[model samples]
Target: MQKLKIAIITLITLLSAKTSLAQQYMKFSWKDLNIDYSAFAYLIDSENVIVRINSTQSGVLKLAEAAGKLRVHPGYSSKARVLEIGIGEVIYSKDNKMSGSFPAFRLFQENYDPVTNKVSGRSYVAQATKIAQKGYLSSRPDVKVQVYNKLSDVQQNVNAAAYFLKEEAYYKQFAKPSSPATNNNTSTNNNSGNKPAASQAATPVTVHLVLVGDTKDASIGESVKSDLIKMRSLFQNTMSVNKNIKFNIKEISGDQLISTNVENTVKSLTVGSNDAIILYYSGHGSNPKGSNSDFPTAAMIKSSYKLENMGNLVSNRNPRLAIVIGDLCNSVPRTRTALPDQPLMRSAPAQHDPARVAQLLIKAKGKIVSTSSSYDEYSYSLGNNGAFTNSFVDALTSAINSHSNMSATWDAVLKQSYKEAYNKTRDIVNKTGTKGQNGFYRGSVAYN
Candidate 1:
């Protein structure tokens, strides 16, 4: 318990005492539209608005699903594909309507024709409505989310063109700095007397979010994007009570996540004694030649950032503490039962070697590193989130809020995350197997 308490406090106390901004919100716009509605499809509008949340921070887009009810789709990021979120009626009303009076909104994947493999008949509004009335809606949804592999189903009810245009225009205007981005929310310290009593030095806690989103790679999907947003939200909620830490976050994302850019970004930053660094990567994780192999080398991955190289970069920085997590397929398969429902639209489970996994862990040894998949089992992602990373974010946020004192340590946090990722990826394989929820059906009678 003492070790755990120190570990938690060490992480929190390392931040600089001064105030700084977090990369909290990203103004989103439609970047791609691949909704699976076939050549001939019905275009209808059910319920939507330009977008507004009375308060600045609204995290209400975290509930209701029908790709089989109450499912959670982690964050997603793509260069070509973009999905914007809508504000539910729950945000507008203050009557606590959600408890009973006001029903919950449902989100089901649009259905496809069993024979043609094209989305047949369905309105986005109707699908969402059904989930509100019929699906297993949660008063407090805690189910492990199984990411829908087919993204077109996730945005089943959206109007591609119109939505893209509206959000793009809106983001262009909103992201622009208003009045030189000035803020009047600072309070004066008023230490006018003698020398201010030699105050304690503010520790510098730099959180670098090095994310890679290969939207062009269909395999990558939206998980990367969602991981970025959710990670920030998790930290925000967890650190809300601790005012002593000053946070500085730098995002090396999109095309900039290449090796050169990543290296340069690290070089440009400075870390003082007792300072800490938090590193997160969610793109593609590969091992020796992208195939089954013997023990892996330090930097075997061929994506934006190499595994070993990333570890070394942080070590050179010499931060008092660091956590580097990689959510990708190292695919070292130990024998596990095959995923269910393959005859339908499911992909086979990946085989990974445990020895290879150990090699990858070697590079991350000093930095509390974690991989999404073990030996050769391919990891999964959904929406704008990497499946493992989403679970990771959830575990951290939940751990922080678990005890009022924030007493949980790095081990506890990592344990919660790894367990969740294992279960989530396995469930996705099973549920998405033969006879899946790829189509939609509305009964003659309403759900309620």
Candidate 2:
């Protein structure tokens, strides 16, 4: 009897060690949406659960179904089984009224012990809430329990098994390897900083910036002006390093903000193969009814022009890179009231690395088309600056000031900017009861 007891204790220790190892946090990517997910697996009592952190509504739904179909052979608890799959709501409330809710999910487990003729349960819940200031979801621990007595209880719950099973079938059709065992899309940090190769350093490049703003609009005129100034400053600071790199900026505002003038300006510009052209417009914008494209049209005083047209023109020049940005409302026009300036707590200034800036602006090759708001969303302005523009500038600034040993990518900048803009818009809407805005970006830039 003593020897048997020792063996049992040894087996229990081994199982606990295995469970601890399995609980290591993992990262995954949904390549279809270019979204990354992080999760960790662990056991709750005798039940096994996988918790995914900071996921979108689609991601949570998909993951919840995947969790239901997940079968653990020789699981931590030999008699454990998946009991439930559902999303936890992150309710956004104002004045005691629910304004919005972000979707979150968790996997729950139940175990039966034959010796004790008893059942036990536990769950791991993850909330899909924005990280403060960062505006993106991150993995954090949040656990809750909702026990079900039997299989019938799970069926009776609003989060029915049938729903998860149906979703599981739909997701299984296109599901790539998301499990840690098969996940190989891990991101590695490049500590090489922004140092260009000798050949790239010798290449002469010219960055042409065409900034267009509608300074006539009473609502966002000052904001447009501020955006232009900030953008010019960003470019000048970034390009100040290489003597071989020429930085040229063109401003078209006031009466020259017409579509013809804008077209003429882009038409007359001559770009070389080693050059980059950036067109930024800060003004009213809209999506026409039944518009096919996801991009918005720049709403000028008397006319509206498609941003895709400008993007194509810039791309036609065959420059190394082309970026077209429109910071405007994609929905119907509405009167915007500028909020009073709130003093922000400033952090210590980051030391800028010119080589890193050059890597993104000069060495990179490809086009980027982005907008301040998605279709049918309002682009917001705070004080004298558009929220998206502020977020973009901040992202760029952070990239430039990143650790000298770390590499920066335009993709990261764009994603960060989009998330930050979304968070900013959401916060403003929550506070002032304004419409929310979510920025969008597409295209890729390749950097060596």
Candidate 3:
């Protein structure tokens, strides 16, 4: 009798665990220009959710009745509370009146049916996963309410079906412990923090310098190869002074020849650890269109910027300083459609990308981001190379008329460089035509 009783208890415990695991929960979806909670709800409802439009006064009351009848187990209703939304909040009710009472019960913890429309059940799971991956859960419990509500409407029977779906996605991306694959890849990234004893013994702070120029479209056009020379020569001079510090000057390779090489160049420079990096780019540039909707508006480079592969380089976490000199024409813009929040524009090819430069700057810790234009300005080339490049050379050679800390020295030089580049580009464009003038922009930003 005792053995039989123990067996029964174990069976019951196992069954309870299974039941708990199967419970359903709400899945949160962010509002985009294309879709939101209403659409998400339709997708969660077993893909058979019917579109219910509240066009008449009677229809809303019917919705209230339907909503009120739902029960997780017994009399519990799954309606949402009347809470303040951004800007303002509207009280949802079965009756359209300012004072008269009507059915206003909230949905079950897992139900989030909108008052106006019911969504079909195809887009909800996808939206929920997206919101969770962005790391916003700690701040928004309402998202939890909204998600589980959708699950109850799905008829999944489990209270946590939607929540599990989102959890599965998050675990896939971040669950793995550190492994050999991650380590080997780290080595290839040349991002090692360890330095030779000699290197460590030298400078208190080292600057990572990334110098790129001669963009694919305007590579001195082959005609100037022999007759012309780099106007600014100090790019190599200043960094050579410190043997302890290293500079990874990127070489043009294969397809990278056509795009912004900042990503690869930084990868080479950041190998091991240092103090700071001075990143500079010169070549052709153009504006990326801003998005008309929620989707990112991409930057359309005259040449490719290879923004996507930049992930490896932008992951740096060390304290560093950066000096970005963009000598290419049309490198800056007025506004962008793609905000940093959305990573949608990563699809564009290398030559026309806008996010590469901005993304890299964002990842560098203790950094500053300088550009070559006002929101409406353009940058331009000087004599042989671009004006920004010439100024960079002059600054390093004289250390901006000082031998003190490299940071202050570089800052002074960049200021002068921006002024010179702006004036020179503008004058040249004025003489050429308005079309040329539109392409002339300048900026000197210090990143630390």
Tens digits of lDDT, candidate 2, 165-244 = 22222112223323464447654433243444422366678889999998767777766766775576567543454445
Report clashes for each candidate as comma-separated counts.
35, 1, 59
| lDDT minimum window of 10 residues, candidate 3 | 4-13
**Where is model 3 more than 4 Å wrong at Cα?**
1-207, 215-235, 253-255, 258-265, 268-270, 288-303, 306-319, 331-365, 400-410, 428-448
**Residue 302, model 3: Cα distance from true site in angstroms:** 10
Candidate 3 lDDT by residue in tens digits, 303-339 = 4552212222443634344343444333233221111
Identify the candidate with maximal TM-score: 2
Ranking by TM-score: 2, 1, 3
Question: Which residue segments of model 1 deviate by more than 4 Å?
Answer: 1-83, 86-209, 236-240, 289-304, 332-366, 402-407, 427-448
The digit string of per-residue lDDT tens for model 1 on 1-448 reads: 1110000000011111233322111111111122111111111111110122221113222111111111112232111111123222121222322321122222222332223323323223222333335442322122111222232432342223221122122222223232452457654453332211221223323344444343234445334544654565334323422323455666655545566666777777777654556666666554544644321222212443545456667667886555566666553321112232111111111121212211121112235455565443455664335656656655554443423232245565566667765655554442214221111111111110
Predictions in order: lDDT: 0.36, 0.55, 0.30
Q: Candidate 2: where is the Cα deviation over 4 Å?
A: 1-200, 335-337, 402-407, 428-435
How close is every model to the real structure, measured as TM-score?
Answer: 0.46, 0.53, 0.35
Comparison by lDDT, 1 against 3, better one: 1
RMSD of candidate 2 to true structure, Å: 22.7
